[model samples]
Target: MKKQDTLSPYIHFDRKDWAELRSSTPLTIDEDDIKELKGLNDELNIEEIVDIYLPISRLLHLHASATRELYESRNVFLQTNVKKVPYIIGIAGSVAVGKSTMARVLKALISKWPNHPKVDLLTTDGFLYPNEVLKERGLMEKKGFPESYDIAELLHILSDLKSGKGRVEAPVYSHITYNIVPSRTQVINRPDILIVEGINVLQPPKNGGGKEIDQISVSDFFDFSIYVDADEKTIFQWYIERFKLLRGTAFRNPQSYFKKYAHISDEEAFQVAESIWNRINKVNLRENILPTRHRADLILRKGEHHFVESIKMRKI
Candidate 1:
């Protein structure tokens, strides 16, 4: 493993050094709150929250404060009292690598600051194309890939949010149904802070028709972004474990799209999980997700048991 100082464009801190930075930041979240925030099969604990996530929340608060000051300054220069837009944060990582858990934890912690900014959490899963559309396009097997998302709609939603459009509506997705709920929507008012979490949140714009045209991606609106990272072997193991766990829980539900897996034996389930990882999730991670890690403002590198081993923050 490379030493902390050896990383370029980022200042790295090991677990101890990072924990020491959590000065005076009260751990506002309790055990019950943590239970509600953690994802299924995730190894998050209160100790990890106090040591790893508290300092991150403080840093995010500082960044949000700085952004507000800049916005005020710009408004003054323009001599117009424009409404301040929300500060957007993006979180990206591989499947089963715990990005959703980090996003929920950060949202909880950040909302407890003295300013008490109204924070909203959004996941890009809702922006994925409906199952019918994917099946019609013969892309059902590539569900989590970048192309499977309604990128234009996602861009429009983020663009509207950043432009101070109040009461914007986003589609709602159901894990059990494995599709968008047609009549359901999540209304996001003008929040002071918005956290968008997804696998492809850090992806850059792709070229179009061999023409060089300026394009804005969903990430372009992000004020700060984080990438949750871990070794591929660790992620693979976690993904398989989560698959098995879900089979015994969510997949057993009659409404679950994955209900077919519920009847499989543990050995059969393992084989199916391994096949999906090798065929879909692993390929998506290598070709789409991992390449964008360097674009993040901060990277949380996790070790065994999903504990944050080190943190890397990009230097200003």
Candidate 2:
């Protein structure tokens, strides 16, 4: 199937003609402009980003500003209505497609904006079901799948934030141990901007009657959303590289759950990685993740080398 015809929220980029499609909004930021958040690497430095991400940062700022005005107008129209607060942005992508890095970068950039100086970042990993629950359900292999997360908790938290609730507490996940530790909730107090980045944040609410209770989806709380997109082949390569890097770093820690994978041979590691990808991540991507691509406000399409080569914006 052609890239654009896919129903996913992301638009895939092949080596065609995209140079002319680069944004012409004249929104650019150099390294000196945002020295707060550490760049992922020298390759992701501001000079390499100004032409690509700067305009995106500006677009997000504009969207946030407009959303604030919209709420104010509605609040005025309904005299009894308290102001709906906090512009929420959801960032979704595969595990190693650099969504976390993008979210952190945006958090830093957006917080610097005068309109919303109190931006916060949250990850859905924190909401995953406890290890005991997963084991009881025989779903250890489906860890990153939507079923692995505590959907009820996630939904409730998002609902509270959308209703302008103050001082929301979210649990923290340890990447080193790959588990939800205890009592480590992060408090987000009256944030102007909330960026929720997760693998399945865009999944639709389950339908049907009877035992299933209908509820609002997490995507319903988003004012704007971004999907970091790239080809599956490229993402696989990136994931393998990331896994290899983590082995020497986080995976070697005594408290890490993936310690078993730390000492595997390169060939064995590749097999394990491919096994996890093919059976788990790829299934989630094809079934749940990719189908939600069209839901994104902006799709940042990356090239073979992992740099965002083009962007597709949903028509207003």
Best model number under lDDT: 1
Candidate 1 residue lDDT tens string, 41-138 = 89888899988998899899999999999989988999978776899999999999999999999999988999899999999999999999999999
Q: Relative to the true structure, how large is the alpha-carbon lDDT of every model? A: 0.91, 0.76
RMSD of candidates 1 onward, in order = 1.9, 4.1
lDDT of 2 by residue, 8-34 (tens): 544444323333333553333456554
Best by TM-score: 1
Against the true structure, candidate 1 reaches a TM-score of 0.96
Give me the overall lDDT of model 1: 0.91
> Which pairs of residues have clashing backbones in candidate 2?
8-293, 8-294, 9-292, 9-293, 9-294, 10-293
Model 2 misplacement above 4 A: 1-43, 81-84, 209-213
Candidate 2's displacement at residue 192, Å, is 0.2
